[model samples]
Target: MANEIFICHNCPMTRTMATIGTKWKPIIIYTIGLKQQRFGLIHAKMGLISKKILTEQLKELEEDGIVKREAFREMPPRVEYTLTDKGLELLPILNLLTEWNSRHHQADFK
Candidate 1:
């Protein structure tokens, strides 16, 4: 038989983690937030992520169907990213994780 794509231990949660478990992926998603964001603006907001890494991460997110990337044909050229329906589904989960972290580390959170 063909190799099973996911064993019993590797389930949907594991798949989700595989998709967004990177150190920067979640932060990227949160930074994008509710509105579409341009590449330069996102880089400015993130500050720490190098341009190369950000580009790679955005490509991955776009490939995974979690982020939509649109390019405009204009003089300088422009691109924007927004969360897809699948990505929007993750917002509540990310919020809950934030709430949990705040609850556990009350001193650090405001």
Candidate 2:
């Protein structure tokens, strides 16, 4: 008799968490989902996140294929960040999380 041990290499939940499992990633995604495409706009909306950290997060998101960054050449350089299909797919999940938080922590708002 031969005994074989099988191990699951990739877990969907782990992969998903590794992608957007940060204090800022989801908020950044939600802000982008709201149509704020420019860096300044996203930064302004997030108010508390430092520019360095925001830039870093955006870069990571872009590298992970969740966000797309477009740069335009002209007198002033313009760059905009938008959700890729993968990022768009994450919107509903974020929405559900938002709804859950609101329902359970309604008192926090007051």
Candidate 3:
């Protein structure tokens, strides 16, 4: 027991951050919203993010069970991304954070 690592394995915050703690993860989740969106649409919504980075983030979110990827065997190989139930649960929290920032970060707006 003495040599066991203290990595906050049981901490909810730590686990949450581990799942969606990157600059784009939360934004990506928010962007996906309640409907499915294609990779191009998500990329279009977030114009500043590189395609490579967006692909990587989406893959991570899918792996973490926060996002669902649906690939179709169609002519153009259509792929869409949608938020899973676990990801939907984070929307309200993200909204609260947005409100908090709006109220508290007025100076930053300028």
Candidate 4:
């Protein structure tokens, strides 16, 4: 039974990478975590990602169940992106990765 379960499921790391393997996904997640929900705010926070790429990434994240996109019907139409529960669950892991990178490569960031 255990072997069957293992065979039925993807390796955790592989599954994680499939969801957020790209160089920009984690940064996008972190930016959303910071309450920068609007498209413009996220684009501004990233500073270098082209709008097209950011839009693509956001779409992928939304499809993967890691982010939620809500559109408000109003005069100008406001859209916001927020992390889903699944994405919230990844924050601690992201924080650990950030801390590990900082500890090992402090000079690079400075």
Whole-model Cα lDDT of every candidate shown, in order:
0.92, 0.89, 0.91, 0.90
TM-score, per-candidate, Cα-based: 0.86, 0.85, 0.86, 0.84
Best by lDDT: 1
lDDT of 2 by residue, 14-53 (tens): 6777889999999999999946388988999999999999
Task: Please list the residue runs of candidate 3 whose C-alpha ends up more than 4 Å from where it truly belongs after superposition.
Answer: 1-9, 107-110
- Taking all chains together, the TM-score of candidate 3 against the true structure is 0.86
Candidate 3, which ten residues in sequence have the lowest lDDT sum?
Answer: 1-10
Query: Candidate 4 lDDT, tens digit per residue, 1-110?
Result: 99968965777777888889999999999889946398888999899999999999999999999999999898788889999999988888899999988898987777
lDDT of 3 by residue, 1-110 (tens): 53334556656778888889999999999899898999999999989999999999999999999999999999989999999999999999999988988887996777
Of the two candidates 1 and 4, the one with more favorable lDDT, higher being better, is 1
Query: In candidate 4, which residue pairs get closer than 3 Å at backbone N, Cα or C atoms, i.e. clash?
Result: none
Candidate 3: C-alpha lDDT:
0.91
* Higher-scoring candidate on lDDT, 3 or 4: 3
Sorted by lDDT (best first), the order is: 1, 3, 4, 2
In the order shown, the candidates' Cα RMSDs to the true structure are 3.8, 3.8, 2.9, 3.7
Error of 1 at 70 (Å): 0.5
Instruction: Please state the error at residue 65 of candidate 3 in Å.
Output: 0.5
